[model samples]
Target: MASNKPALEGPVATVAPADNLPYGHGLGESGEAERSWGEWNPTEETVRPVRGRHRVAKQRGLARSSTVLGVGVIAAVGAGGIATAQDKPAVSISLPDVIADNLPDATSLPGMGSSSTAERDTASEVLAQAPLTSAGLTAADSEQGTTAGEALRARILQQAEQQQAEADATQKAATETAAAVEAASQAKKQQTAAEKEAAEAKAKAKAEAEAKAEAERLAKLAASYALPTSSYTITSTFGQAGSLWSSGQHTGLDFAAPTGTPVKAVHSGTVKSAGWSGSYGYRTVLELDDGTEIWYAHQSSMTVTAGQKVSTGDVIGRVGATGNVTGPHLHLEVHTAGGAGVDPMAWLNGKGINP
Candidate 1:
């Protein structure tokens, strides 16, 4: 018999004893016998590894926890550092707020992810280095002339207009003066012609009157020199009536004789004039020396021309009442050299003859 080997130290496990059979048998409490081998199909106990030594070293929980810690560190870095920022000048230029509510709260303006401070500084430097361009309107003006040239042109136009106006005024004044002068001349000529015509008419009238007066004086002288045809008694004398005539009294002698008696000249004189008078019709005048004139009026007939010469006692005309006389008698008047008719009877008596 071999000496029994000492059991190794390990954890104890309970098992059933097998019966003695052949090369692979185990003793049991029962007197039966069983067999087993390493080359056989495995049993439950043989297929399992040992408890403490055969455990697996798993890492699923460790991998999950490490990934979560990494995500937390990244979130802390993304928040930046709002609490550690410094105070600086904050500039604000007002514009209409469009996205004020949606805008994120400002932390650090110049963080690793922020661009506000750098962008603002760059813009200010660019503006300071810029140059302003001047306006080009004066160069683009269309007119080529300067303001002085325009002023000169305006003065020239004004002077030309003034000269033209002065010339027009002078021409108008000259025309008016000429017209007025011509009108005044025409009026003067017309007035002179009217005065000349009136003077000619007055001279012609005076000449005619003088010729008529000379002719009458000659006729009266011729008629008075003639004698009545028959002698008769004198009924009234010259200037005998107190209130019988408008000229105070009778101016001639009256003869109470027969009607239609032949009358003759009492003196030698030329037959000068014969005519009708208002108070003494069919009258004649006879003229003598020293310019005395005699009248024989109220006659029926006369046998003499204006220039016929007659002798005293010649029957020149007949006696009749052809005037304002009431009876048939000769109306006679004598005149001085001054041509005023007077009483014929007084002149006849002064001539040494009975009237």
Candidate 2:
């Protein structure tokens, strides 16, 4: 230790005396360090413990600054100094009262207030109180206490439910479309069937109307004509090939009856002849207005004279065996306007009169 260094000012630390000092060095009265140690030995009894007054000099308002400086000085020392300091008793380091009172609270630091743990917990609680299912959400869910993990679980569930709802809506739309198509098809088919049925019914009604008209025409014709004679049986028809016929084939219809049966005119006409025909015996010939001729042969007597007007159903003669016949009968014949003989039965049918 050197004794030539100048003493520091203000509140210096005091050291205890060495028990065995060199011959010339000693503690001056009033506890003054008179000389520095040259060759001295220290013992437990001679060494005094450092007390409260042993402290660094106060820098007035620069207390915190002085503390910081002291810590810097300790750090600047080399590792050997640190090892020597380790051999000493452990020392307690504390901030000055005035410096600690002037420091700000830890919670007031930047990034520590708004982003505090209390705020984080409140956010987690809000999320956790939300409904777990996406099907619905209501304001009342917040009444329940909540947790962070539950909030996350609720969010996942809500997303899954939303996706499922979308899928269900899409499927429902598709099903409705299919149903609409089916209904339209069915309606179209029914309409077509109805149209076809209506067409068939119209055709049937038209055919029935035509048939009724034809029947009315036949009825009118039947009223205008009549059978030649009553109580008579058809014996032979025109075009009958037999040995008894003079022309090799019969040219008339034979109506067989008892002698003196009355014969009537078939239609309104004038008598053309009332005299005897050679093979026809006593015959009567009547000519219609259209030049068609009707002959009544094999008659016993004639009531219509030549050029006499006779109406339909007027008595004209009597059936007899006068013609070339084996029994009493009237031979009736029909001739077209050209004098061509036709079947009498067919001619009568054409007039709507069937014998």
Candidate 3:
């Protein structure tokens, strides 16, 4: 038969079976089994190998965690890069030559996935390197940005008020100018009316004064004239055609009166003749300062002597039918400047006397 026991590799030791044994419980209990079973015993060598395997598994786990963290950091950097691209200014800005020296570079900042210690140091360096004025400007810019909108609103309102005030001033100036012009026009109109009224009043006073002077002249002329006789009737007018006169037409006015009616001189004059000549019997002739002779013919008697100065209203003769008369009457004739006889009635009317 083939050997049932297998060979041992290294140093081997054997232990005897116990004497008290249960039936069919020894290594030879089942002859058909090809291997023998042994009880486990802890040893330093085996425990040390198990401990090393556990350390290896821990190492693998730490490597996997580190890879995951790196992936997350790369994703964050990619996202930031995309955001920066999207937020880029439409036009690229170039720093001014003066300020370009003060600007910081991008590479000097902490990169993504950098060590925490490096990030903290970089942050501290950046803060320390910043100018004090720049830091203050950052804070001031934030505050000023917040108030800039309010300032703009206040300026807009102020401009609106200023414009409104200007408009009001312009309107007031226009109104005042118009009012002044209207007032001047009104004053001018009033002045014109007053001047016209004054002119009319002056003209009226002149006309009244002329009328009064004319009346006074007429009154003075009336005082110097007189009628030849009173209470007498006119029998014949000058230029009357009658067969009783020597001429074909009557050359004088005849006043029919009673036999002894008085006849007066018509004006202040000298008696040129008082005796009868022939046809003019019992006659009187009065000569005035203007050489106008007034003849009183057909008189019963003559009262004024020849060449005697007679005043107006002096009785020159008595009315009678003494020469070629049909009845008792006075024949009156007027001669101007030694000319032919004129109408005695017309001569009396020229002196403002209605005979």
Strongest candidate by TM-score? 2
- TM-score against native, each model: 0.34, 0.55, 0.47
Model 3 regions lying over 4 Å from their true place: 1-204, 234-252, 277-281, 324-326, 338-343
lDDT tens readout by residue for model 3, 1-355: 1112121122211111332223423445453212221211123432233222233111222123434333333444444522322333333323234344433443433352346568788889997765433322344556766344455566689899999999999999999999999999999999999999999999989889987886676567667878888788988899999787778899988888898899998889998888877987788888999999988898999887988998888888888888788889888899989687888888877677776
Give the TM-score (vs. native) of candidate 3. Answer: 0.47
Which candidate order results from sorting by TM-score in descending order?
2, 3, 1
RMSD of each: 32.4, 15.8, 25.1
User: What is the number of residue pairs that collide in model 3?
Assistant: 0
| lDDT, candidate 1, at 150 | 45
Q: For residue 188, what is the lDDT in candidate 1?
A: 88
Count: clashes, candidate 2? 0
Candidate rank order under lDDT: 2, 3, 1
Give the Å error, residue 74, model 2: 13
- The digit string of per-residue lDDT tens for model 1 on 193-220 reads 8788878888888888887875576566
Error of 3 at 70 (Å): 12
- Stretches of candidate 2 above 4 Å error? 1-182, 246-248
Candidate 2 structure quality by residue, lDDT tens digits, 56-143: 3433234336444333333333223233334444444454565556555545543457567777888799878755554333344344
Instruction: Pick the lDDT winner.
Output: 2
Cα lDDT, model 2, residue 98: 59
